[model samples]
Target: MSDAVPLLPFVRRDRAMRWAVGIGAGWLAAFVVLLVIAQIHPSTAIVDLPYLVPIVVAVGLSFAAAWKTSGRTRIAWVLFAVSNLLWLIGEVIWVFYTYVFQRGPPAVSVADFFYLSSYVLAVPAILVAIGSSGHLRHIRGLLDAGLLALGVGTIGWQVAIAPSLPHAPRLADAVAFAYPLFGVATVTLLAAVGLAGRHRLPAWAGLVGAGFAVAGVTDAVYAYTIAKQNIDSNWINIGWQVEAVLLGLGAVAAIRRPEPETRQRDRVRDLTAVPLVIAAMSAAGLILADRLDGGPITGGTLAILLALFAGVLARQLLIIRDRTRLATQLRAALREQERLAITDGLTGVYNRRFFQEMLRIEAERADRADSPLSVILLDLDEFKKVNDGYGHPAGDTVLAQIADRIRGSVRAADIVARYGGEEFGCLLPGVDEEVAIEIAEQIRQSIGRLEVAVGQGRSVKLTSSLGVATAGTRGGHSLDDPDGLVNEADSALYRAKATGRNRVVAAGMLVDPVYADPDLPIGLVWLADRIDAQISVHEHSTAVSRWSLLVAERLGLDMAALRRVGAAGRLHDIGKVMVADSVLRKALPLTAREWEDLRRHPDESARLLTELGGRPDLAAVAAAHHEWFDGTGYPRGLAGAQIPIEARVIAVTDAWAAMLADRPFAPTLTVDEARVEIERGRGTQFDPAVADAFLALVTAGMIGALAEPARA
Candidate 1:
């Protein structure tokens, strides 16, 4: 795994190298000039401090080398690469000048030869490093070739350093030239190759190579002058130093100029040797211990060095071990956070959000596996009543029980979720419609039988309506169509609840009786069931009232009963909703609909229950409830029980519920008015028996607890 960079000390070691090299070059230039001047005036070599020349030049070279070396580059690579390029040019020129140009001695010291040839192996190794920058990952062959060449050159240099038999002067010249020649040849060849592969190195590296070659020729001329005793060589010495420095700087610039490989390798330090912090501490302790030891701290300080080294080693181990453990723990934490984001809390089911995510996944799986999947959705029936009556805590308990039942009923492979407040969903993988239906039915029954215990020593019986939708992976498939599973299951669930309650229904096309003789296909059966259920549901709303004629249709109360019931139920002091219990329970009567409306009950109820659609049966019977059989009604008039059965029945019941009601209607109507109203309404208003039946049902306490006030 890759890591982000840590903040670290930013010392420009690269700039340091340039300073050291520049300083060293200045001093070296003066030395070369001194030597040239001394050649012109031989006596000066003896009279002056000629020896001081080496010292000054060496100091400058060391400073320049150290400073230049202080950069962000690898010390080994610089030694191996850049230094070699400089040495190659310098040695070839110097050798050619001293031995080849003026018919001078061809012999060369082994020490000199060994020193210059070493760079040949060095340059390519670093170049190899600079080239293998993962960006060129496809060029393994080129990288391998560079590495191989570097190895061969290094081994050859080592072999040359071995005691080859001493040679004659001329042979030595040829051999000496041979080492620099080999280096020159390799660099030249690689330059050609790299040029051909210009795509690899930029144009500048090639130009750098060419410039170095030209400078090499100039150095050769300067070397020839240094060898000759008869030259006014100030120009040659100055020219060589200037040329060499330029060439050296040029090579370095090319190397530093952001090659992909150089960056890749340079970025990560070789902290493998020791933890950086411990290395710092070790370096610190060494300096302190050295200073304490005073006079040229020596081998006798061995014990101190050993102890410091041990501490350094221990710190490194601690750093490595701790870092490893920290990385592992971090990864584990990341994984856990990922898990929680995709999970649901309450049902431990996936939740709708995750279901959607999984559905996409399963849709793909279905295509790949060539299988089927179905979604089953379920919602609790009369869930609001449970919340309103038993309380929300009970509602929650019911939902939990439902979720558990769903889990138990679905196949283990299926995924289930608490779809929403009162609704749950399941995804059945590799299961078709038939199996899905069976599973749905099972879940439906499971919920129905569940008993949820809420607080207050009470338990609620539960039932759920279910919808099932299915789809196959056969077509040019996609799951983005949100309705596929959703619409069907929703339609199915609607059907289940619509045909009264506690029933299952399917979504299928309706077939006319003429074309339908056979039992429906399973799907058709479900569809038909859903259709029938949907049509059969009765509309009911708060527009319903005790004496509303609609109540007569319910109880099978007759026509005259319907008319009186309608009259009483429709106007049963619709006034009360607006009236205070204090005003309503007063011993009084209203002269008109005006009096009842002031209380706002009738008007408010009418507004609140605006459309009569939901309460078709009740609204119709209630519309003309005040119309007397004698055509004495305010809103509308119809005489002699020319009213509906529901109206008549509601009239009787309304009078009864009111007589028993604590309202501002004649001191809660004594048993006498209750009976007087009952007898008085016979024929003219009530269907005598209907009125009599209401009296009996009312007296028998069938209208139980009417006189009791349950409202706070």
Candidate 2:
């Protein structure tokens, strides 16, 4: 997880680092020159008095840095400036006493007050500079640093403060002890910032941390010397000048530089192992101290060791809690991902793939137990009309509502799934055909009664046609395989739609003469069933069958010829299966190439009927169904008396059926509108005699009621 960075760009970090390096080099050079002069004259005031030059230089740079920054950076620089000024005042006081009065300053003098105050303020100033950049704000960071502080403070108190209490003066004893305590605090903070990835932090923050770390060691050394009364000319005074120069360089680097870009790590394990090392060292120090002194652990040493152990224990507990919370979240996310993989995103139902897998598994279980398994396939009647009239979103609402009703109507053991568009499947184990049919009827009624809301306070009523197939009812290839069983159920569904929709049909019990014939080849039979199902799911083929027979009767056809024409009207579009669904179901006008491909279906239909069924009369009627009365139709256009009477009658009624139906390319027409279109196409697109017969049936109130408007 990366930290959120502000969109604005900061000043280039490279430029700031270069500036810090230049200032640091100059400070290094000045320190070397001062150390060389002090070596030659160890006992002279000249060596000590020249130290004021570098101290003044440190003060000037710190004040300049303070003048150039803002926010927390400005506050830190200002603190550095005051701290350096205090050190300068302390140095001047020491000089005045040693040179003018020609003696050392008294114990706990004003110089001691100024020097101790500077040490106290420098701690928060370093802390502020570290925090001025936002990467160090983690709670675990504070805990880790606190653990280091606890360990180091335990050892510092035993080694420095305890040894000092025996001989130091009463007024100077507490003052001498406070310096090492502050020194331990500074070391803990510096360790914490350095252990955090250094390259990820601002360039100036590391410089500041290093400066404070150096100052902390020097302070601890000074306190040790004062406790032993060994205060003399040495490297300790030079350490203060080095700290001042480092702080000055840090402040200068921070003046124009912004916070560095940071990448955050989410895990606590990403941090370094400095805290563990510190803990081990502190424990070892207590053991070594007791051995050197040849005694048992003292009260102060034991108490500090116990506090260090307590800090370690608390840190471990926090890690355990974080792991527990993370594990729980991982389990929940995995479960949700598993559920989504098998479910339909739109309806929250098991999809087709899962439904098929369950069918196979349930079939095998039913075989083992010698029980019956039934499958019901439900398809909404004229579902596309709902979409064409109210939009697809409303159609989705209706499908979801119907799925809920099916779930409510079935048993809890039944598995309901959306098998495909506007089609749902239910697996009912241990249910016979009779029970399955009754359950399917109950679901059908449940859906028919629902008034699903579409939009704008408008609701639409719908009905479903269902088919049920049970195992072991009529044993055949269907009983041997799960796929065959589903096909049987689908065939029954096609019959339910063919004989008029909104009814339940059971497999092996269908009585429709055209579908019940076993003489038809199974492949051709399945193909014909699929074609009829596609065209008449909204009762298109049924209407054409009825209307064609009525028109053929009026045109003075015999009973045998009327039966043949009716069957032809139902099977004329069977060859449409060869055409891609993309062409047939398109919502746009067909191109010339697509039209050329589509016009071949009638000839293909004729060839299939003659060769497969051995019936040339039906084949002839199928072939000429699209032939116009004029000389403009496709595949050998026969005009006037050349076109067969059966084909002419079908062409008129088929056109009327298409007009009343909700098609993708055309809107559904009202009864009078269809009658007007039929009259307009009398001699051009349709046979004059067949068109007159159809218009007469409409005028006589015989077939116009079939095209009534859908209920809202």
Candidate 3:
């Protein structure tokens, strides 16, 4: 595949392909240019034929590199590499024999063909330093420049000198102009391309293209000397030798140098017009000084002043615009931050701080203008007990619905805030006692009729208690008082709560302060007991959850992240409330139908927790608890880790728990017996890691809670 393994330290398949493509493209381009060189030197058969063997090596390497790396990438690109190598071969034959043995002095012979043809191998050596990307990056532009420059040079030189002699070779006629013009155009183009890009490869390629720089200079000197018929012209070979050195320099620079990072920065700087600015300034200054055209002294001075002023103004304008844009951006950001500060994220209501601030504004306004303003106080009944019973998620839903209903009933100008817990406050602008009471009643009734759903088909019928108070001007003096009004409204609210919630009461000029009673941790000890109870749950739940986790861990998932799987796994069977205890504890064989119905624990567990304010992510895991790694084991036959990791862990743990716990249908097994059962199930039903961990736990005396103590 490699033709031979590259012994060069830098050799690889990539370098091989790059060299092949570059040589193929370069030579093919050279041939097209050589056609122009041929025309200019029709009689000079050799025309020095500078580029040949490089073509054949390209073709040869294309085949070799393609074979070497074909298996790693697409076969077609590899084949393309082979084609490049073959093209190199064609360039070799044309360079030496046909032209060298023909005539035109320099003592050339056809015998030098093989000796010259061997020079193509130097390319692969270059590939040792620079890789494939360098070749492909440069070759196209190099070929194009060579063709265009050679074509132009041929035409220019032939036209300039061909008219002098009828039988003279075009090379003698065209060499003076042909060599220099073509050389300059090609080298300059390569330099331009190299300087334009950011990638090191392009710049390197450009520099390599400029490698022909010295060759062009030598040809120019030689043509001039030969045409002059100078006898000692051969002594000028010393200067011409410099051209060969430049060629080698270009090749070495292209091969040894890495891709340039400056290419991109240079282009961006160009686009920025920094140079253009300098050029414009220089031209303006020169013109003002009367360098290009005649001008009155007075007018020249004015123009110079105007030009300097304009440049300074433009620079200042750009700086000012950038600063202004930054300031506007910062202002907008602050406005958004302020807006978020006042709004409740969950229910989109005015929060406590904003509501209080707005109330102060409206109350002061009402007092000054001799206008009426009323305030309403409200609280949802049994809010805390509902949270404790159904879970906090359900409590949040109840609060959200209460806010929605109150919002619908209040005036557009009214301000509302969550006072605390289930309590809320509303400030009514331009409304008196009667209107406030009506609004408060409407809100109370609306909330009373509302139904917010929890898990399963269960829904909560929400109700709230409301209190209303109003203040207005009396005898041209504003009779408004914020603290007094709030207190009266609160007293009325307490009255409603006292008389079985879901009703509203008017303050009716009463202004006694109302103190809210404290509600403590309420059931802290009960919660503690609940937490302690879970230790037993963990033991039984571990039978399936741990096993499922082990299987999932050994199967593929990271063992560390298995906490989600483990937590879900541990709680997998919490839904047994729906399964009859009779069925769970039955000793005899279950009918096929009973077994079918018993597998519904995961679904029931998920539903149960959802009602209990469980996290949605945890609920989802519990729902799929019975699922197994293999599609064969489940209510839904999912295979190959298709089951949730949590479900798999829980499934294994559930099995372990059932085996160890006393059972009517089967004798309870000790930890060791349970471990054996799991090991027998590896790959079939249990995960290997799960079985091993369980056995290890038993063996390491970690089975204190797992095994019953023998009686003395």
Per-model clash counts, in order, read 37, 0, 39
**Residue 633 error, candidate 3, Å:** 75
Off by over 4 Å in 1: 1-329, 364-370, 389-394, 473-482, 509-712
For each candidate in turn, the TM-score is 0.31, 0.51, 0.33
lDDT score for candidate 2 against the true structure:
0.72
- Per-residue alpha-carbon lDDT of candidate 3 for residues 1-712, written as tens digits (9 for 90 to 100): 1121222323233464356345545654555565565666653332234443343333343344334332222132233333233323333333434455553333233322332232223222222212222433334233333333443343433343333344646433443444465454444434434432233343223333333455455555655554555524233333323333233223333233222322232244432223224334544544444543475545534553455445444544543564576599899989878878987766678787887777778888987887888889998877776787778998888788789898998978788878877889999988877567668867866776677886777787766778887877342113455767778788889976763355566675211111111121213213322422433322354334324443454456663445556455545566665666667667788888778767876677677556663445667777765655555665666655666655655555667776776656778787668778877776667545554655554454322232221111
Instruction: Report the C-alpha displacement of residue 133, candidate 2, in angstroms.
Output: 18
Each prediction's whole-model lDDT (CA): 0.48, 0.72, 0.52
> Which segments of candidate 3 are over 4 A away from where they belong?
1-331, 455-457, 473-480, 509-712
Ranking by TM-score: 2, 3, 1
**Which of the two candidates, 1 or 3, achieves a greater lDDT against the reference?**
3
Lowest lDDT 10-residue stretch of candidate 3:
511-520
RMSD in Å for model 1: 20.4
What's the lDDT for residue 580 in model 3? 67
Q: Give per-residue lDDT, candidate 2, residue 123.
A: 61
